[model samples]
Target chain A: MTLQDYLPCLYALLACAGFAVMFEIKKPMFILLASATGMVSWLVFLLLHDIGSEVARYFLATMVAALFAETFARLMKAPATIFLVIGIVPLVPGGGLYYAMDALIGGNYALFAERGLDTAAFAAAIAAGVSVVTSIVRMAMTGRMNRRERETKKEE
Target chain B: MRAKQVERCLNFCCETGRQLIKNGAEIYRVEEAAKRMLSAFGYSDAEVFAIPSCIIINIHDGERNFTKNVRILRTGSNFDRLDSLNALSRKVAAKELSIEAAEAELHEIMGRKGYPAWISYLGYGFAAFFFTLFWGGHALDAAIAFFCGLLVKAAMGQMVRLKANVFFIHICASMLLVTVPVLLTALGVHIIHTDKIVIGAIMLLVPGIAITNVMRDVIIGDFITAVSKLAEVLIIALAIAIGIAIPFGILRALTGVM
Candidate 1:
């Protein structure tokens, strides 16, 4: 969409890129991928319609980003973490954590606890979803395709 | 051309070894091998470096089997400087690098710079305003709590001294540190809204934000680096917590705030 709405993601990408460059990481593609993820995330956030749309958009963007990272790792013969860290920086639950900590200190114990749980759940969902998606994709590429044939195959 | 790079590596290793020797690291020809590796990685001007305890642990833990007599320094160069040596090396040459020494040396490096004054001030300011505004704290109590937060973070950094255990140390230390100091202020021993003040003061001690970011980055799979940086951040958080928690706890019981 407009450049303004995308500023946070752009800022996130630049920050990720700056840090990666600072560390002298050799992988340039990761920086590009991270920058792209920010834009892609924003775009997905916009195009989708209603109901579970927000969650669906996040899932799709995350999956695409994760798949790209996983696939990039396979092609480059490098560790996937390099791709993951940069790509995910914007997704870090900063606002959530800040709220949780704030609620915690303010003595709104229930809100505090709930926010913390929410943050953890969000974090776990991201981690597990990416891992499972990437692993399943990898398995499919191994030429093991076929549920019916696989039933006979397992029996055999 | 390649050999010239190797020559640079060799030069760096020898030079680095000399520095360690001068510093009393009980090291041998580590500089030489490091130089070789540096050259292979394309550093033509990396003349010196210090070691990090992380590598030492890896060495001692049998993860790596470099000769015992020689102590090696571990460095993760970004090649950012190397690529621009012909252009930017002169500019960056004056910047402090990430190269470090074994535990004592690393600690010394951290200790020497001390906490940046601005960071401390921010912690203090946040402690005062945030505690009073959010936690209904009073002025004097907030001030005390804020100072306690600063003190807690500092103490943790100085006293904990536990190598890899730093993360957990930081977590517990920070949690208790923030909670307790303000508790002192709360009990009205010195100030009532102090716990809020202390927590705000040492909020920097909690690397939760940084660690979450690190994990998020890793979860996304852009792992070219940031792993070590995350570790460093975690340590800083731990130091903050340790610095605050002890005093708060003591004050709590002493003030009857328990």
Candidate 2:
């Protein structure tokens, strides 16, 4: 609702566009979609983190991001990984991993363990979210194909 | 007979798989593309097995069977190349492109250049700058992180040109990531938060591709690839941690500086 609330989304868009360049994404349209995907997913994560558990925040954010990527992939006729990689950039546990390593090097065992576990959990949650959605999408696609095939056979 | 024609087609198909895998395509997708191309060329009994580093393909034409193994020694992300290759495979599968034509197209795709080094450097700088802001850092920290990101990108480009090991490249990049921010702080630039800047700049080196691929490969039941990729992710993480830790430890031991 406020300007401050929109800052993170703007940052996500810029960061994702930067990532699209780093990945050498050639298509301008795909770059825009990827950045939009990143912004929407990061906004969702921000909103969820305010009201949900830490793990659910990452899980739901990734799932929604993958959903966007898959939809875009279908519409664009490109591989979903293209969108998924850049879209999920905002959710990667880069900071947590850094803090974990920093703590370990600083000889703070407790802080190291805490940050390490948190990073691992976030990583796992992201993986789970992506896997679940992708699998469901795959199943639905194949099921639709099979039904069409059966209908054509019956008509023949 | 038609054995020679089948041989050429199978060769083209396997090469396509190799290119896809080399460009960081998932194992399942590579296999699917290869198989689809083979079937389009009238070899429906083709089998393709693609791993992160290699692809093995077998094509059967009646009583004659041909098998080829391609080992991919290097892989990187170039989405442009990936998109073109994916399009090429789809065209081949749809019977729109003959084997020879597809081969030429593949060559063209492989030879296409990515964005120049300067553009990638700019990308790194912007990514760090925005990530700093996203992580709640002020304008000063974001500016410092942007410079650090440019430095890291340039250093990485130099390391790649020198044919340095990947782990060494990551270690060196991360070392620069930590050192630059701390050096700035030591120079009395009090507005920059060293922690936020380092975190932001380090995002440039994080293994986002590896982590995503690991999950995809595992879900698709390619455990070998998933486990290997997981190992790779951990190694890169370790290298980065070591890189960041050593400099901080040295700085602390010598001058009690953060």
Candidate 3:
């Protein structure tokens, strides 16, 4: 692919930075890092566009974003939602939601059903991706804590 | 601890949860933070439950059962406040701050102000501009979307100041979002695509992130929160759709084309 194909990732990064501003993220370093996650995930989505199905691409992209958010949250000692919310903005299916509504308003039930379900599926895919990664992170954290506690108890 | 001290600690914990929820902390985080603070205060048996709009804390300190419920009417996404709040809770959990200090810090966090309105408006404008290009819009469409984004933010700010309903505010903002692009296209802005402009500007109102996070609640076994948050997202989406349709409906009636 030509350089033109990568432009969307750049735009996604800038859009995420704008969202980061609106979300009131204070630190410039955190904003840049968070927005960079968006760019990276969008790039991942685009790279797999041809080979992967629509739902799979969104799911995998969201997983990457969630992973980045989790890593950043741990390092920065901030809430992961800050990064996840901004990073996933460009991936949100606004067009699908709008088209579904447009179809419903225009009295096209078939199109409405198609677009609405497509949007829901995509949203579900993203949700599943986030949930899976968050669950893994939570489990890993708990395991580490439990191991530490056990070691301390043994020493005592 | 005395009953009065227990009561005060409960209040502090409840207030912390309220702040967390109000500033857009996840349901699990709110519950966990509240529990940690309660335990740190030597009330390990305390139980905390929180949904999107409410938090309930219960403690049985030998003699009596004490419970406090905080009703959160609205939630706003302010990551700055959330970050500080999280840090404050961590300090409190580590016993680094006493009740008085923690309360003072909570007060400070509660009173913290966001960025000026103009900066957020610029943020909206630039976000829309970039999103339009991300969606493959021409430079002209992106330019128009920037202004539409600014106008949307300004309109929403005014409506919020007037205490209008959230759904009404979105409907109005979205109607304004569509009207600008369509009006521009009608007024010989041949280079602009209304669809691209609308798609980009609509991001400001969409609940996509909420829907994504709601699933986390479900995964965390907070079914009540998940369902309630999902309902809220659906309602917001419907409001945005209705907002979008109004302009097209008006245009169709006025000139028979949209």
Top-DockQ structure, candidate number: 2
lDDT of 3 by residue, B1-258 (tens): 499889999999999888888778889889999999999999999989888888889998987999999899877878889899999999999999999999999999889889897899889999999999999899989998999999898998889789898789889999999999878766776777888999998998876457766967777888888888888898888788889998888777777765
- Residues B148-192, candidate 2, lDDT per residue (tens digit)? 989998898889889898799999999988998777666777777
Residue pairs with backbone overlap in model 2: none
Q: How would the docking of model 3 be graded?
A: medium
- How much is A32 displaced in model 3, in angstroms? 1.2
Better of 1 and 2 by DockQ: 2
Global lDDT of each model? 0.44, 0.88, 0.88
Residue B179, candidate 1: C-alpha displacement in angstroms? 16
lDDT of 1 at A47: 49
- Stretches of candidate 3 exceeding 4 Å from the true structure: A104-108
List the DockQ of the predictions in order: 0.07, 0.81, 0.75
After superposition, candidate 1 runs with Cα above 4 Å error: A1-3, A27-30, A45-58, A144-156, B1-165, B168-258
Cα-based lDDT at residue B239, candidate 2: 91
| Best-to-worst ranking by DockQ | 2, 3, 1
TM-scores of the candidates, chain A only: 0.72, 0.96, 0.95
